[model samples]
Target: MTHVITYDIGTTGLKTCVFEITNQIQLIGSTTEGYDLKILENGGAEQDPNDWWNAMCLTTRRVLQENHLSPEDIQGISFCAQMQGLVLVDKHGEPIRKAMSYIDYRAKKEQKEGIGNGFKIGGANIVKLSKSLYITGAVSASVKDPVWKYKWVQQNEPENFHKVHKWLDVKEFLISKCTNKFVMTEDSAFATLLYDVRKGKKRFSREICQMFGVKMEHLPEIIRCTDMAGKLTEGAANELSLKEGVPVFGGGGDASLIGVGAGAVGPGSTHIYFGTSGWVSTVVKKRVLDINHMIASIIGANSGHFNYFAELETAGKCLEWVKDHLAMDESNLYLEKNQISEEKAVVYKNLYDYMMDAIAHVPAGSNGVIFTPWLHGNRCPFEDPNARGMFFNIGINSGKSDLIHAVLEGICYHFRWQLEAQEKKVNTSPVIRFVGGGALAPITCQILSNVLNRNIEVVEEPHNVGAVGAAVVTAVGLGLLSKIDDANQLIQVRDRYTPDPETKRTYDKYFPVFQSLYKNNKKAFEVLNSQ
Candidate 1:
C-alpha cells in the first residue's frame, strides 16, 4: 500500500504523521520538542529557524522508529505550516535572523501608514513590508512587503540583514532544509500579503513596492500547493530515515489545510477554528474580494479554488490571559493539591472547567454583561488592530462565572459579526464545522451554536486535520487522487451539535448590546491607544 507522510509545523510545535493512502489509517505518530517564544521589549515575537529544523528532525526520526517502516514504504511527504511568518536566508541557504511570527506586532505603525490614503493601496498591503524600486522601464513600484520583515532587519540590524540572500516562509525554509531547494507554495505566499489574489500570480505589485520599499528578488518562487518542488536529498533522507528521492510536494498555508481537514473543500461550506486564535473561513469557487476590505481573501490549495478567512485576534488567548492574571491564586491552590507544578496547564484547565460549569448555569448573553473579544485586536469585519477588549454593563452582583460567561458570549458574538459580513458576499450558510483545541470543549461548542443559531459539527480527529489535509494534497500531487474532491471521501466527521432554541433566543437578544458596546467605545479605544 502506498503511504503518505505529512507534517504540520505550528506555532507551538511540529507534528508528523504517517498514513496509508489507500485506507487512510494513521499508523505512526511523533512530535518535535516545542521551542520557546522570545518576546522582546517592543512587542516583538521571534523564534530561531534552527528550532524549527530541530523539531522537524526529531519528529521525523521518532515517527520512523516508532512505525518501524522502511523508508521505501513512504511514497511522498508534504507540509502545512503557520502562515504570515518571515525568515531570511543567505546565498548558502543559511538563516540571517530569527523568524518573526505572524503574531508579532512591531510593525503595527508601519502597517497602518502603508494602508493609509497616500498611495491608495488596499488594506492587505499593511500586513507585509517589501521594497520595490522602479528605476527601469515601467518600474514596478515595490514597497517592502510585510514578508520582508527581514528586510526591516537588514535596515535595523545591518550585520544580520547583510548576511541574508533569500527570504522564505516557515514552510519553504523547512523544505529547503530537507531538499536544499528554495520553493514556497502559493497559498503560503498569499498569506504574506505579497501575492495578488485576484491575478493568482506570484509577482510584487509596483504600487505596493514603492510604498513599502522592498526588493522583488528577495521573495521565493511561489508554486502550486500540490506541485513537487524537489526531491528529498540523500543526506536528509539518511538522517531522518527516509528513502532518498521521496517526492516533497509543495504544501499550503495552515488555514487552507484546515479547510480541507474540516471538509470545507466545496463551495458553500464554512469552517470555524478556535485554537490559540479563532478564524471563520469559507471556500469559494472564485475569488470574493471584500469591497469593504474587512475580510482577508487568499488562494486555496485546490487549483482554481479561493478562500476568505475572517479571524478573531484572541479567542483562546483571552481566556488564557484571564486565567493567568485573575485566577492565579485559585490555580496555585489546585496545583498544590494535585502535586502539579506547572501553573499554566493545571490552572487553565481547572479555570476553564469551572468557568464552563458556571456559565452553563447563567442564561445566554451572560445575564446582560457584554464583552468585546478584542484582547489582541479585531481582524474580521472591523480589521481594527488597535482595538481593545472590554466588558460592558457589569452589574453589582457580577462574579467570576458571569465574567467568564460574558467572555465566551463575546467570542461567539464576534463570530456572528463575521458570519453576517460573509453572508452578504457569499451564497452559502452551510453548516459551521468546528475544529482545533477549542472544539473539544462541549460548553464552548454549545455556546457557539447558541450564539450562531447554527448546527456545529466537530471532527473526531481535530488535531491532525491539517496533517491529513497535507497528506491528501501530496496524494493528489503524486497522481494517487484524481482531484481535490476525491480526497473528501477519505475524510470522516466524528460528532455534531445542534443549537438549542432557548439559548439561541437569549443570545440573539444580547448580540445587539454587544454591537452597541463596540460602536460606543470605538473612538475611546482609538484615543486610548493614541496616548
Candidate 2:
C-alpha cells in the first residue's frame, strides 16, 4: 500500500488527511485546524495566507504524529480546496495581500462597471455576456466571481495589485508554497472565466483578459489535475515535518474533486454537497452554460469531463445560524467548549444530533412554514446578492422547532431547484451521492431524498470526501491508480435513502411554495437591501 497526504482547504478551516492507497482507499489519520475569515464591513471576506500555512503545518504534524508515521512514509501530497478565491502572490510566492474569499462580494462596483450595465439580459450586459458565453461557456457576472475581485483590487488597491507577479486560487497558492512552482490546475484556471474552453484552445483567453483590464502575464502555468506540480521544497518540507522531495500533484477545487471522491467521475454522475456552502453538480461530457439560471459546466479533474454546477452560497451556514439563534439553549448543550453534564451528554453527542432528534418529531413541510436559505445572498436559478433568508408562512402556532426544521428543509428545497434546472440541460444520475458534513445526519439524508424524490447514498466519512478526491489525484500521479474513474471501486457507500411516499407528498406541497418565495420577494429584497 502506498501512503499519501491530502488537504481539504475549506472556508472556515483546513483539514489534513493521511490515506492508504491500495485496492481501496483507507483514511488512516485526520486532523483539522481553524483560522479566521476577516469579514470587512464593506462586504469583503479575506483570509491571511499565513494563517492557512500555519494551519497546514499544525494539521500535518498532528495527523502524522497521531498515525505513528514519519515523513518517509508519505509518497505523495495534493489538495482539494474552495474555488474562485483571489490569491495574488509576489515573485517569491508571498501573498501580496490578504486572499479574497469566494464569499467576498466587495467587487459590486467592479461588477456593475464590468458586466452589469448597458443593454442587459439576466442583469448582465448583453453583448459582453454573449461573447463570454461563446468563448468560455461561462460568465463572471456574479459580484463574488474571481474576475471581479481581481478588478476590485486593481482599481482599489493599486499598490498591492502592482506588486502581484501571479494570480492564484486558494489551492494553487498552497501548491506554490509546497513546490515553489507557480502553477494552477485546469479546474482552477477555468474558474477565472478568462480561460478559453474551445476544443483546440484550452489556455487563458488574451481577449477576455484585455476586456476585463487584467494582465495576461499574471496567470500561471496550468496543468492537468493528475500531473505532478513539483517536489516539495526544503522550506515547505521543514515547516510541515515532511521530506523535501515528496511529490506534490496538481489537486483540484472542491467542485471538481468532491464528485470524483464520491464516485461521481463518470458522465451523468450526480452529487449534492451541503457544507458551509452547497452545490448540485453532475459530471458531463461537454461544457454547458445556462445563463438564465446561473448554472454552468466547469472543467473537472478528469480529462474531457466537466461538472455542471449550481451553487447556493449558504447551506449548512443557515443551520449554523439557526443553531446559534433560534436554538440557542439547545446549542449550548454541545457546541460550546464548556463541559456538558453526563446526563445531557448521554442524550445528544453534538448540536446536530440534538437538532435532528428535535426536528424528527416535527412533521414534514416544517408545519406549514417555508424558509429561504439565502442568509448571505444567493446564486443559481437566481443571482440576487440582495436576497436574505426568511421564515415564510409562519403563523402564531409556529414554534422554534418548526423554524429550525424549516431551515434544513429550505436548504434541501434549494438543492432540488438546482437539480431541476440542471435536468433541463443534461441528464443527472438517478441515484445521487450525498456527501459533506451535513450528510452525517440520517434525518438530513431522508429529508433530502424525500425533497428531491430521488435516492440519496451516503458514503463512509462523508465529510472527508473532498480529501478522498485529492487522494485519488495523488494516487493517479504516483501511478498507484491508472485513472480517476477507478475511485468508484475505492469508495464504499455507508447508507442508502429512498424517498418516503408520505414524506415526499408533504415536501412536494411545500416545495412549490418554497420556490415561489424568492420570486415573490425579489422586489422586496432589493428594496430593503439597497445600499
Candidate 3:
C-alpha cells in the first residue's frame, strides 16, 4: 500500500505523519519534535531556518524507524508552515539571517508610519498600518514590496539586507532545502502585500520594490498550491529516510491547509482556529473584499478560490499566561503538599480540572465582565496594534474562576464581532468547525458555541488536521485523488457541540457591552502606550 508523508512546521514544533492513501486515514506511525522561537525585546521574534530543517530530519528519521518502514514505502512529501514569516537567502540558497517571524513587532515603526499617517496606495488611504500595508499597497517597492517584514530588515539592518540574495517564506525555504527548488504558493505569496489579489497574479511589484530599494529577481517564482515543485533530491531523501524522486507538492500556509483538512471547502463552510492566535475563516467561490477591509481576504488552497480570514491576535496565549502567572501560587501549594511523583502529576491535572470546572460553573458573560484578547493586539474589526486587553466590570466578588471565564468570553465576543461583519458581506450564516489546540478545551468550545449561537464541530484528531491536509494535497498532486471534494468525503467528523439557548441569549445581551469597551478604551490604550 502506498503512503504519503506530511510535515506540519508550525510556530512551536514540527509534526511528521504518514497517511495511507487507500483509507485516507493516518497510520500509527508518526513523530514529533519541538522547536523554539527566539523572542527578543520590543516584541521581536526570530528563528534559524536550519532549526526547521533539522527538526524535519530528526522527526522524519524517527517516524521511519518507529514504523520499521523502508524509505521506498513513502510515495510523496509535502509541508504546511506558519504564514507571513520573512526569510532571506543567498544565491546558493543559504539563509543570510535569522527569519523574522510573523509574531515579531519590530516592524511596528514602519507599520506606524504607513497606518498612522494614512499612507495612500492604489488611490486609498490605509488607517491601520499592519492591515493597510499587508492588504493594501501602502508599502515601499524596493524590497519585493514593503508590506513584508523585509522592509524592516532593510531599514534597520542595512548590512544584512545587502548580503541578501532571495526572499522566501518559511515553506519556500523548506522546499528549497528539500528539493533545491525556490518556489512559493499563492496562499503564501498573497500575504506579502505585493500580490494583486484582484488580478490573481504574483510578481515582484516593481512599484513597491522600488520604494524599498530591492530588486524583483530577489523573489521566488509563485505557483499554485497543488503544483509539483520538484522531486526530493538524494541528499534530502537520505537524511529524512525517504526515497529520491518522490514528488514534492507545493503546499500552503497553515490556515489554508487547516481549512482544507477540516473540510471547510465550497461556499458557506467556515472554520475557526484557536491556537496561540485565533482565526475565523470561510471559503468562497470568488473573492469578496470587505467594504471597510476589516477582514483579510486571501488566495485559498485551490486555484481560483479565495478565503476571508479574521484574526484575533491572541487566543490561547492569553489563557496560557493566566495559567502560568495567576495559577503559580496554587501550583506551588499543591506541589509542596503532594508526596510522590505520581501524586504530583495528579495534583497538576487536578488544578487544571478545578479551573475548568470553576469556569464552567460561572454563568454566561462572566457576570458582565469582558476581556479583549488583545494581549498581543487587535487583528480584525479594529486592526489596532496599539490595542490592549482589558478586564472590564471586575468586582471584589469576582474570583479567579470569574476572571478565567471572562477571558474566554472576551475571546468569544471577538469572534462574534467578526462573524457579524462577515454576515454583512456574505448572505449566509454557516455552521462553524473548530480545529487546533483550543478545541481541546470543552469549556472554551462550549463558550464559543454559546456566543456564536451555532453548532461547533470539533474534529477528534484536531492536532493533525494541517498535516492531514498536506497529505491530502500530496495525494491529489500524485493522481490518487481527482478533486478536493473526493478527499473531503474521506475526512471523518469525530464530535459536535451544540450551543445552549439560555447561554446564547445571555451572550447576546453582553456582546454589545464587549463592543463598547473597545470603542471607549481605544484612545486610552494608545495614550498609555505613548507614555
Q: Highest TM-score, which number?
A: 2
Q: Rate the local accuracy (lDDT) of all candidates.
A: 0.73, 0.91, 0.75
What are the models' TM-scores? 0.86, 0.96, 0.89
Candidate 2: regions farther than 4 A off: 330-340
Which residue pairs in model 2 clash with each other? none
1-531 per-residue lDDT for model 1 (tens digits):
678788888877788888787756354564556776675655467889888888877888788778787778888999988877888898877788788876666665454444442534444332231232111111111122344354457556888876767778888898898889887787776666555543443554554545455666777777889899899999888777788999999978788888887778887789887766778898877666553535645678977777777767678777776666554555476666534346555655665665565467877777678878887556567655457898888889887678877777788888888888888888645578888767877888889888888888888677677887898888889888887778776777888889999878888788887878777888887777532
Please, what are the lDDT tens digits per residue for candidate 3 over residues 1-531?
Answer: 578888888887888888887866665577889878887766667899999999999999888888887888888888888888889998878999998777666676665444334565432344333343543333222111225477688788889888888889888999998889889888887777666554543554665555434577877898878889899999988888788998999888887898888887777788888877778888777666653535656777866566777777678778877777665455576665433357555664645555676577888878767787888556577556567888888888887778888888888888888888887777444578888877877888899998998999887577678887887788888888876667788777888889899888888899898899878988888787531
**CA RMSD per model (angstroms):** 4.8, 2.1, 3.8
Candidate 3 local distance difference test against the native: 0.75
Off by over 4 Å in 3: 112-148, 197-204, 211-214, 291-293, 330-334, 337-358
| Model 2 lDDT tens row, 1-531 | 899999999998999999998888999999999988887777788999888889999999999999999999999999999999999999999999999999888888899999999999988999989888989889998998999999999999999999999999998999999999999999999999999999899999998888888898999999999999999999999999999999999999999989988888888899999999999999889888888899999999999888999999999889988877877665466556434557877999887777778788988888888899998788888888889999888899999899998888999999999999999999999999999999999989999999999999999999999999999999889998898887788889999999999989888888888989888989999898756
Instruction: Name the regions of candidate 1 deviating beyond 4 angstroms.
Output: 23-32, 117-151, 196-211, 291-293, 322-362, 393-397, 527-531
Ten-residue region with minimum lDDT total, candidate 2: 331-340
RMSD of 2: 2.1
